[model samples]
Target: MKKYRIGIVGATGAVGQEIISLLEKREFPVAEARLLASANSAGRQMQACGNLETIQETTADSFKDLDIAIFSAGSKQSLEFAEASRQHGCVVIDNSSAFRMDPLVPLVVPEINPDDLEKHQGIIANPNCSTAVALMGLYPLHKRFGLKRFIASTYQAVSGAGAAGFDALENELKAQFVPEENSSTATKDSPFPHPIAHNLLPHIDDFREDGYTKEELKMKNESRKILGNPSLKVSCTCVRVPVYRAHSISLSAEFSQPVNVPDAKAAIEGFNGAELWDLPNANRYPTPLQYAEKEDCGVGRIRIDQAFDNGLSLWVVGDQLWKGAALNAIQIAETLVEKKCLKWM
Candidate 1:
């Protein structure tokens, strides 16, 4: 077996930490692991592959000895360091929105487009968290029944906003029991414009003039690219829920061919990275609590949509930090390995 040196940017953050754990958990033939983060988090220590690795500041020099680099930092970090890593003869699989829509970079979901790795110009882009979860259900159906369009409403977790968002939700939940005098200390600084303890925020990212947010737009555009459906009509409403992890999406899709409940359930069950959990009569369906931290996305509530002639309605849930971000990025690398797409190797 061949082992490759790997580097994880933003090693101190939530998604970055998951990347570290997953690399070891899934055993991706890592010979060496380098943890890189901002200067402030440089000296931090993290456990990986049963050893404590020291975090280093991310710079151009970070990738010289690495075979693969996974970027879990924000777009700014990816934009600044991704090309530099690629220039160092390293393949970059990015978790940010940096190069997803770039014609040159391959926007991949390993289950949907693993073969696309062959054309990567040293960088691969992971889909949006919500888009990734939605596709786990939609893509399989698209294969069985040609998909026409989809409308989705996502109940995203606070973890999607990162650790700070998690803290905000935690603090607010604690503040509920605190007296008014000390409540300010708990619910003071929040990443969301509104409270997320028990309430919901329909907005996820910056709003556009068309009344859609950037996060909403990501689901539309990214889905089309991954599915190879440029004209695919997608409308999504993104919401932030108080959950600590995982994301749930309510999807209604129109397909070219007629869709029935049994065939739809069969498609989901047979798909890789997706499990059919529909048993509403038994009071079972995919939920954020059920799918959190699990690798497979769960799809349930399959039914024929009355709104469209050949349409279906379903619910999908997945761990955003895993299938949505870290797991997906790692899968890209695994696909590259399996397909022998790593040019540097």
Candidate 2:
């Protein structure tokens, strides 16, 4: 077993911090871990594997001598730094929309398309959170039954918007409970356009002229690429919920062949990286609160959808920061090593 010198861009952000925690928990053979953030966050210290590591400013030269760099920064940073990291001979796993639509770059989900890792040109793009969470349960079923169409409604958490979104939800909740000089003052500069404490916003990302949001379109396009089915039909309505972490999806999928409840449950249960919790008798089902802070996505509420003959309705919950972003990137990095695409540092 060999170790790799790893660097995490945007180390001070929420996803970046989760990457550090996951790398430690999974024992991913990291020889050295460098935390890099914006200039203001330089010299700030963060804990990784129980040792304090100082955050460095992200510059082109920062990637020198690094073997693997996991980037959770926004598109602006990824677009600016990804090529620089690759130019320094480092394998970059980017968790942003910057390169996902690139025909050359592989938009990957390890369990579904591990082979895509071999085609990477120094950078691999992690799928969006809503897309990732939906596919965690839907992909396995697609394998069992030929998937033709998919309609999903996402119950996304505030944390998906990063730290600012989380703070806004907290402040709103606190304002609702605590007395304030004026309620408006508490949520004057909320991260979201409206309150998220006791409300559900129908929009996730900016809406397009066609009525679908950017987040919703990511699900449609990314799913087709990952599934290798360009003709696949997918419609999604991504919503922002008040929860702190994790994301849930109500999926109704129609397959080429008829799928029964028992078969669907079996398909999900037998799949890797997914678990079935469809025990209606016990009133147990997947939820954001239950799957928060966990690795595996939970699938439950399995039943035949009444709308379509070959359709099944299922609910899935997964940690958006983990499987949706950090863990997925780490898994891709692991796949790169396992496939000999990247050498140990």
Candidate 3:
């Protein structure tokens, strides 16, 4: 067994913390784990692989000695340090939008596209939280029935926005004294334009000229790329809800072949990293709270779509910090190891 020296950029963030915890939980052959963050976050102590480690300020030289680097930092850090990490002979698995659409970088979900790891040019991109969770339901179906298009409505958690978003929701929930007539009475300081404690915000990310938000478009664009189906159409509406950990998506998809509920359920059941939780009699379906902190995304409410011929409607839920970010990034590293794509190989 070979253990590799690893570096985790943005080690102080919500996703970054999850990455560190997952690395220890999964026991991926790690010889050393260096936690890196901003200068302000430097010197902060955190636990990783059973030892309390000091967080360091990330710089160009951060990856000089690491064999693999999993970046949970946002796009700015990824764009600035990813190439530098790669140059240092470290395989960079980036969990940001920085290089996902880049023709050169492989956008991967290990269960769906592990072979794509072989095509990496030092850096690999993880898909959006909603995209990754939704795909856990859609990919198996796509294999059973050729996928053509989908319409998705995502109920995203506040944690998806990171710690600040979580705090904003938490503060508002605690500050509520009276029932305000309007939901807009929410704190103006919230990261979201509206209060997420009780009301829903139909917007996620910046809105585009085409009326779809950047987050919604990410589902469409990233899905197409990962599925290798350029013609696949995705119409998505992303909403921010009060939940604090996982994300849930409602999907109505039309496929080329005729689909049935039983087979659809079976497809999801047989898929890796996905669980079939449909039990209508028991009133069971995938929910964010239930799936929070769980590695496997849950798919339920499987049925034939009423709107489209040869279509199916399903619900999917996954932990935003886990499969959506940290777990997926670590899974990519595991895939790299399994595929022998590391430097030693």
lDDT of each: 0.91, 0.89, 0.91
Q: Per-candidate TM vs. native?
A: 0.96, 0.96, 0.97
Worst 10 residues of 1 by lDDT: 177-186
Q: Candidate 1 lDDT, tens digit per residue, 1-345?
A: 999999999888889989989998999899989999999998878788777889999999999979999998899999999989999989999999999999989899999988778999898999999999999999999999999999999999999999889899888777673335423232566788877776778989899999999999999999989988899999999999989999999999999997888888889889999999989999899989999999999999999998977999999999999999999999989888888879843
Lowest lDDT sum, 10 consecutive residues, model 2, at: 177-186
Tell me which residue pairs clash in candidate 1: none
RMSD of 3: 1.6
Give the per-residue lDDT of model 3 (tens digit) for 76-133: 9999999899888899988989999998888999999888889888998999999999
Instruction: Give lDDT: candidate 2, residue 327.
Output: 93
Q: By lDDT, is 1 or 2 better? A: 1
Error of 1 at 296 (Å): 0.6
TM-score of 1: 0.96
Model 2 root mean square deviation, Cα atoms? 2.4
Q: Which sequence of candidate numbers ranks them by TM-score, best first? A: 3, 1, 2
